[model samples]
Target: MDPADVLNVRFHYGGEFIRIGPSLDYVGGDTAMSVLERDKLSLPELKGFLADHLTVKDSMKIYFLMPGRQLVNGLLFLHTDEGCMQMSEHITDAGVADIYVEYNGEQDEPEEDASGSDFEDELDDLMDNDDEPDAVITAEEEDIVQGNVQAVNAVPEQDILEHILVPNEGGVVTEIISSPVKHNIRVDALSQGSLPRLSRF
Candidate 1:
């Protein structure tokens, strides 16, 4: 395993978030980045940097560490400026996140259609309710939601700290939910971001 072999690279076994990509002027070419470098860049930039260095950007995927030291699929970075989330904000200075480089080619076979199309269509119809008027919401609804969110959305400082602590891995745990369930369990609300809508009302 020569260090120059970019197709099959793995970073050091540290950090809560194990970054799977190639080295970008960090570490001794074994890991993707150093602790200081990981802290300097925001999470989005770190992802972008990885994509920029890859020959197979399309196959690249990102993962973030969650509560209880679990790795889960992260937001896909379509563009460099998708969001302004800082790595330091979530990861601590002493935290050690590693990056692994590997081959990520597209699937050879095309995706097959699911067998539950009819059932899915029926569910969609029930949920969409197209017959309902599009302009159902009034200014009053927006005002109430905005007021409620602003007043009650502040996450407790300690609770926030709790979310960032991964069990065995290193790096800072800046933000996350209390749950350890994988991406399969996330709904639109929890998946959206921190401070998910507490209520639909």
Candidate 2:
């Protein structure tokens, strides 16, 4: 298949990941889809590769890697009697180029000096050490700051979805699957108050 016709989807698992370039030639098929990588493998073959290499279990974290390497979090795979698997419809609908999976035993440790308490202390110290001691906070300045904060806090849930759904300049949004399973994935992500910012993606 032509490289232009393939959609590159990356699978990140436990510090190791594989990029599978599935052909956009067909929509839904029980048969395997073509892939482009170092060792070319089909969609089903790639799934089998993940099953064998990554530890599949319940409670695993899944994320869609957006453009510019931004990770939109809170996507989780369904764990059935067979194994953990993301709905095939969801995959095709998102038209995602990358998928990050945090399986059991593949959790990343926090970076050194990156704990929440340490961050808070650092911020507090910075605020306390004002470069200009004579600087006074005018009423207008206070109002502006408060207004900005309120605007951020008052952002509607649909706004977040719009931010993700709307295509950027010269970019096209792939058709998304409107199944309940896929809808729930997005809803859950929104509920967490951690939607990806427009500027970031």
Candidate 3:
């Protein structure tokens, strides 16, 4: 892909977390920490930075060097008050423990009204129960009705892709790997930044 063609990309971000994906130029043997080291970041300081300042809310986009078949070494760019900084490596690690916070963007169509009118009446009964003065609730019942109200309680998806690794201390990334995606490989936690909101495109 032409470097210019990659422009206009959208990043997903929330309060702190940002949305990211594997770049188009992932090398076969790269990790978060390794990239950080390559960039001359100090590992110890990087750890302190993450501990001191990092928050991963749901829907935060994080770019990573995808292992295996899909890998690339595309420029991972971030917009900041100073301007844009395009890193040659992918964002390997984040402070938040959750690696990926995917929401139901395109849900599977509800099992085509399998219960028909009976389903409708059951749903109505459940709705009426919500108004009951003191209705006994069970875990099973809650699960059954999750579809009806989960969206209201669902966390809003992160809407920006730009992030900043504000180095409270400053350090480097050594390794980073997703277990399900890459088994037994301990991916390093790279430096964390204070990602500001901006146009990822």
Candidate 4:
């Protein structure tokens, strides 16, 4: 009776996932893992067995996936040897075991270049900038408008002459020319019918 007949084990290490089926009859089978967790397997032997599937260098790290997404690292030799079966039971239902993998690249890479970017520089400058050119133009326009008003107001006043109306026998109205020094007109010598009365409009 072998424990390998009762378990389907899966491991994730060295950027590769290794699945060891219960029997070689399945798609992927590990004859090496079949010998693991037995009383005959040792620490060096397990590491060497893993080396055939993964890069097992000096200071290599190994972690087991536990229940509720917890992780237990292989720190102690004896404890790590036993943790394989214990941790494997937590990941799969009944007798099967597997681990989850994810890439957290987005959350880690943005922290470095966010502050010094061109967009941030432009935004900061826009937020901090201030000045009003329209107000300055309005002030200058007001000064020119005031100067034009003042010039119009300073114009001297001139006397306006009022024309006097004279009535004649011909039933026509005419203006008396009193200011102009000119030749006298012989109105008494002319016939009354020949006298012009109405002024040209």
Candidate 5:
């Protein structure tokens, strides 16, 4: 049989703690797997690597859902073959198989109504509702928006900016504005350089 065709399987590792859920990723290959009882890594040379892990005394072999042809789409190919080995070992150790698997239960999908009653009711409600969203805003909010352009142009020099925005509580938050005097002086200096005799402010 094709390896990929083997979809479901049981695995075992001598340990407590069992975890089972929908596989978030794919695994396969060989490494320190308790199933094969080997410390060194080796890809399961044969399916018996899987069967022994499940602890099947008789012909009751474990089944495994092998990687499908579209391994890329399934996001399984990236996993090292050893990754799968480790995963199976982990799941079996977690008592994933002991929990019991109940088959024949399928999720029911939402069904649409044959009549248009639900659609008509929704349409009528829409027609009856005349409320529009409110346009409430504060004057301070307007000032922030209208002043944003001016504020952006007022970016301070690297040193002063760094001092103002020092890290607090082990995290950094940008300081929007530094000392008013320093800011003004910087702005003035950029616009007008030092003169021979300038009046002190």
Candidate 6:
């Protein structure tokens, strides 16, 4: 995959976190203007790349590399529909400049449980039993399931960005780097109104 397509992307390598940004290019002619060139990837491409490359498991603590080679700790969550969109928005808004992925080794597999086979057999038996009445889930149970789904789908974009932008302890929320042209203006306008300013850096 092209390195220019991703922004502020992180991957685990050799037990360390690696941050990636867009590729740089020079503009044609004598002007000698440097340009940040980024390539865009579709959802399928992104998913496929992640599936093929990422080694760390979901919710793993990973490092994010800053401009000055500073490393900060952050949690890595599995990408969902909302998460993918949020990540894309963050990369664009943050004006990230580099992007790359490296695979150093195979991912560590989860430990096997002794009762796993028995549990699978039981589940299969339950599925094969046609004479048994189907188990009916209650309304409350359905609501609980729906709530869990929503929770999983709700990508905490602000929290993740805040962690990335302001890594020091006791750092003020306002210290985060807001999207210079769009988010900051909207936040300033809202601050002027009845609503208090909610930082979106």
lDDT for 160 (candidate 5)? 46
Per residue, candidate 2 scores C-alpha lDDT tens digits across 4-35 of 44344556555423333632111221212223
Candidate 1: segments with Cα more than 4 A from true spot: 1-31, 35-44, 51-56, 72-86, 98-104, 107-201
Best by lDDT: 2
Cα RMSD (Å) between model 6 and the true structure?
Answer: 40.2
Question: What is the TM-score of candidate 1?
Answer: 0.25
Give, for candidate 3, the lowest lDDT window spanning 10 residues.
26-35
Candidate 6's displacement at residue 34, Å, is 21
**Model 1 per-residue lDDT tens digits across residues 1-201:** 332212221232212223455312212222454322422345455554564444334454443332134233432222332222332234433444334433344323446656459888778778888576567768999999898877645644334332323433556544445443332234554567644222211
When 3 and 6 are scored with TM-score, the better candidate is 6
- Which residues of candidate 5, in runs, are more than 4 Å off? 1-35, 38-41, 46-80, 92-201
What are the lDDT figures for the candidates, one per model? 0.40, 0.47, 0.32, 0.44, 0.39, 0.44
Top candidate when judged by TM-score against the true structure: 4
* Tens-digit lDDT string for candidate 4 (105-160): 21112346556799998888777888543544578899999998897556433222
What TM-score against the true fold does each predicted structure earn? 0.25, 0.24, 0.16, 0.27, 0.16, 0.23
Model 3 lDDT per residue over 40-116, tens place = 23323233233333333333334422222232342222223111213223222331111111222332234655557
Worst 10 contiguous positions by lDDT, candidate 6: 26-35
Q: After superposition, how far is residue 161 of candidate 4 from its true place, in Å?
A: 99
lDDT of 3 at 29: 19
After superposing all C-alphas onto the true structure, candidate 3 shows an RMSD in angstroms of: 44.1
- Error at 151, model 2, angstroms: 99
